[model samples]
Target: MEPRPPSEWEDRVRELARQFSYPPAPDLRSRIPRPGVRRPRGRRWAWAAGAFGAFMLALGILLASPARAGLLEFLQIGAVRIRLQPPPTPSKPAATPSPASGAIPETRMLGILDLAGETTLEAAQAQVPFPIRLPTYPPDLGRPDHVYLQGMGGPAVILVWRDPMRPDRIRLALFEIGPGALIEKITPQVLTATTVHGRPALWVEGPYLLQTRSGRWELRRLVEGHVLLWTEGEVTFRLETDLGMEEAVRIAESLSAP
Candidate 1:
């Protein structure tokens, strides 16, 4: 019969037999030395030791030099000098004021009326003269025809009007209404009516007042004369001339109301 299938043990035996053949040993021909071979005497370590000693000696010499110590000290001194310097200073500015409060002052009364009336009249009379010369009236008459005295004194022009029933009325009219013309520029103030000599009379503001038993005299200035007139109701009496306002007031205070 054909070769039967080999048993497992037989196959393993065959494989082992195949592997048992010895392989040829590697050739150990010539024993040659590698190029640049060195002996292990630790020469590299010795050279390293010598170089380290030389570096240490150089470092020690450099440290011992005065210049090196001086250079280090100079660096330290420069650092201290930089630290010691002061910083820059700043400038100051001017002050200003606020804008809330206003300006200007205040006042009271302004006109002449606010002053005392009698006092002002006295002041006015002191400055001027009265009972001045009357220029010839009715300027049409020829020279020296006839001289008739209309007014009481030299300069006062007393007017006489014909009224049979009121013959004495013309004399009474003088104090009530002055002459036809205002001779002096009289700045009139307040006027009040008073009873003098037991009759109605007017108290007009002027130089000042002299109310006496004789009559009421007022300081007045005509064109050329400064005179005092005693006015009692409708009657006017011419008194002393050339009197001042202050003097008139003084003279007035001395008299009694009549």
Candidate 2:
């Protein structure tokens, strides 16, 4: 019979194993037995076998857990992870009621102003651990109209620029997520693998729910624009705009410390 193909679980395990980084081996030469010292040859082999067994046990436990499995399904890029969930089921409409009954209340969509932790750009910069970067491509594009400091493992800085012609409309928004921070998106319309400055990146076209959890607080917003996600050193950037991919990439590449 032909060789059997690997199962999904097996494939996932192999992928994860490739990404796993093991601790550096300690310097054993200095600890080796001196001229007068005597040690059993089988002792070293037994110790090595024990350590390998323990590591395998831990890996098995994590892979077998449901919670961990869910986390493993996400496509992670730096501080962000995108998970595709099944589309929500549509609800059936109810029959219209008489005048005696009150009309159903309309659900209001959340906008940039509705987000919490609003603050001045200077204040946001001071609060975050990472340096905030600004795009220099659009020479006329000045400073951000609004700045926010929100939590995602740690404090994340958000900068929003509004259209000069239409002050009420946002032109662009940038999220600077530093080390330990994480952003998750659920069921985006499209996700394409891309690259920026030779580093891996993700392009997400959205009308999806984006969420970030920190301690007891959880923030959720509906994203309607395309997002370019990339990382530079320890900082992860998320640029949201209505512009096409080429323009977005140019803007991303023009980021500089301000």
Candidate 3:
């Protein structure tokens, strides 16, 4: 039998198929899992955790060492670093004559004349590169009784004031250490953090061993009074006095170049 003529519905379906467009089929061979191959998941997270653990282990080992622990327990301000130390041992008393037996007790005082590089204030100012400053808080405070200059890589100027009543005793001393000079203080007492003229400072009480080092010179002094340490510009100021913290800070804030 002869094929029947195409119907209208058949013609319409053919026309619709011709007008439609389709995308090419994607290749699935590469994406399919192989029999013996395993993919690594979360590998980045595992690496991160291992690295963190190693850092923590190294830090713990460093903190456990006794000799190394002292390296971290210091406070540095300007050119000075203060370290905590154990209290010094007390010495046994020696036999001596009584005060009522016409014997005078020896008094130890800071000897300004014994310091190196003793010179006039004008001479010190001429030798140093930085300006010399003096405090004006105590209106009656006059000029320094003595001035000393130390060559510690750079110039270190010291100004000393003597008590009028007790000429043998020192009333105040101001140390101006320039760059390259280093000071190390060892104290058994705790140090208090303070501020002078809004700048950071350190207040140390009681007696301490003060050591200063330069190129080839090193000096050690036993400081009996309190100390105020701070930095202004490139110079570090150390004020040694018997005054309280509030008064010391006030004096520090009143410093002016003269």
RMSD, every candidate, angstroms: 65.1, 11.5, 27.6
Residues 190-209, model 3: lDDT tens digits: 46656676556778754322
Tens digits of per-residue lDDT, candidate 2, 1-258, equal: 999997666665565445534445869888788798877764875664465444443343334454554444455666776654442433765454221121222322346656667789888777777789998978888888888787667667878888889777778888888888766665556665455664456678753222222221222332346889888878899988888878888898888854
Which is better, 1 or 2, measured by lDDT? 2
TM-score of each: 0.16, 0.60, 0.59
User: Which segments of candidate 3 are over 4 A away from where they belong?
Assistant: 1-71, 85-109, 206-223
Using lDDT as the measure, what is the rank order of every candidate, best first? 2, 3, 1
Q: Which 10 consecutive positions of candidate 3 have the poorest summed lDDT?
A: 97-106
Residue pairs in candidate 1 whose N, alpha carbon or C atoms collide under 3 angstroms: 126-245, 129-221, 130-221, 130-222, 130-225, 130-226, 131-222, 132-222, 151-158, 197-258
Off by over 4 Å in 1: 1-187, 207-234, 237-258
Judged by TM-score relative to the true structure, which candidate is superior, 1 or 2? 2
> What is the lDDT of every predicted structure here?
0.27, 0.64, 0.63
Pick by lDDT: 2 or 3, better one = 2
Highest lDDT among the candidates is held by which one?
2
Q: What is the lDDT of residue 258 in candidate 1?
A: 32
Query: Candidate 3, clashing residue pairs?
Result: none
The global Cα lDDT (0 to 1) of model 1 is 0.27
